[model samples]
Target: MMQFHDAAKTNRSSGKVARPRLLAAATWAGTVLVLSACGGGGGGDAAPAASAQVPVTLGTAGPGDAQNHLPLAVGHSWQFEGTITEGANSSPTSTTVTIPSTRDVGGATALVLRESVVAGGQTTVIEEALVKDANGVAVLAAADDVLSKALVPYWELRFPLTAGAPFVQLDKTGLDFGEDLDGDGRNELVSLYSSVQVVGVESVTVPFGTFPTAVHVRRVLELTVRRSSDGLAFDATETGDAWFAPSVGWVQRKSELVGMGEKLSSLERLTAYTPGSLGSAGASQGATSTTGSTLATEPAWRRVLRASASAR
Candidate 1:
């Protein structure tokens, strides 16, 4: 929630010096350091081997297609709850959201959410019962911060694929997005614009069932009117092991984020997921089948940032 203030710390405002230090102590961890150790060489790491692009298709997608349900039209609400973890600390969080199924003026959807964060016997709150649109051509509302602001331009683009799209995007402006971990014909979207990376896919065995996960890195930004200079860019990655449920759709997603540097911030295992209440409510559910899903493998990206730029 804190921004990296190179100019602020050097200036004479009220509490600017301690601001950066305080933020570092609370939000900084070993995320960037770990990324550098593994893949942060020369802007980004090497791409996977070359492969063909999966053709986009559409059909009867079930609840498991939640990830692909882009342009989330009007009159839909999803409830979520999870936890955030750092070194020696873990806290619970909850969110209730409503969004338009169609794209608004900017190709974004309108979103309203109520969120609560709890830590150390204290809780912070945020409530938004208003409409917020996106900034893309479709006006599809994507994810945003607590203030209901768009994070990146591509985040505005929604891929309505029956299965995941197999592709990689590398640009110096943001992230080098790429993934095809499962070889199931679908590739994951890894974006660097917000410093969020999809590292790998994970299979988690839980009490109910086993889920195939997409690992992601999410960095919280500092909010400011100046889009270029605002928002804290701390490292936060989550491994989302998402499972397709019969009646309810995708459920039981587990996530985690690790920070870097002296700030010592990190997010442990936070399980945020859609519940089975959809079936219990007697809503006519779709059949469980992999008919419209993709299952092709993508080629490994072997180029550096320059050649990979076209994927952006």
Candidate 2:
């Protein structure tokens, strides 16, 4: 997986330009764009109305409550189409996030959301492996690019949430990050600092449809990378914004790195969503794939991207 905050095109002393990639971060490290932020005026289009009813409440919540109106349940899934733009080139990809199953984490049952993205003729997971429990939602581990080994966990968010509230950051800095960047056995150290802030209710338009009363969340991260092969280190910052609809989870998000001169940005928007059917009350279990999976596997995304990639 690429770093949601990785450099667009690194300038190598040996005259090599790194490939442009739209990646994911253990924590989102981005700077907010002039794009539609909550409470901003003259946005050209009127913000959508608050029609998306909250699956849960919109205000303060406790441990067992759904934070930011996010509905976490087995079988629940969201499909998104991602467009990553660098300079004048852009790459479109598809992703599906589903709660494959549950496991014991921190002594509590955690809903594991598997995020699979197909790129470069391969389907790979983000490696963060989102898990939710009574405490709240947690984003664990770095991407395969950052930590091919040691998993760095972050208790991203806790309950008792409210508008204009500060986020609960689990891990501020991670060290000794291991990943094979150039297929070499040795790489570098990746350290990160992440924070998320709620900007209250707002409306946003996405591919799926128009969502009203979308909970806007902003995330910022600072990454310090140290090379093991050489005594070299660099720091970069990133920012991203996500809109979550009640009961619908995340509807859209825009991610980009700070100080990037070009249009090196990635936009992901929801295309479809379905509530959990496996274990939710009043909802009968739906038919699953032969593998007992709720959503179509990687082959689906592969076909879509391949067809389009071939067309181009």
Highest TM-score against the true fold, candidate: 2
TM-score of 2: 0.61
* TM-scores for the candidates: 0.35, 0.61
List the lowest-lDDT window of 10 residues for candidate 2. 29-38
Number of clashes in every candidate structure?
A: 50, 9
Q: Which of the numbered candidates is closest to the native, going by highest lDDT?
A: 2
- Report every candidate's CA lDDT: 0.27, 0.47
Model 1 spans with C-alpha error above 4 angstroms: 1-75, 100-103, 107-151, 156-250, 261-312
Residue 129, model 2: lDDT of 41
Candidate 1 lDDT over 146-182, as tens digits, reads 1122212222111222234323211112222332222
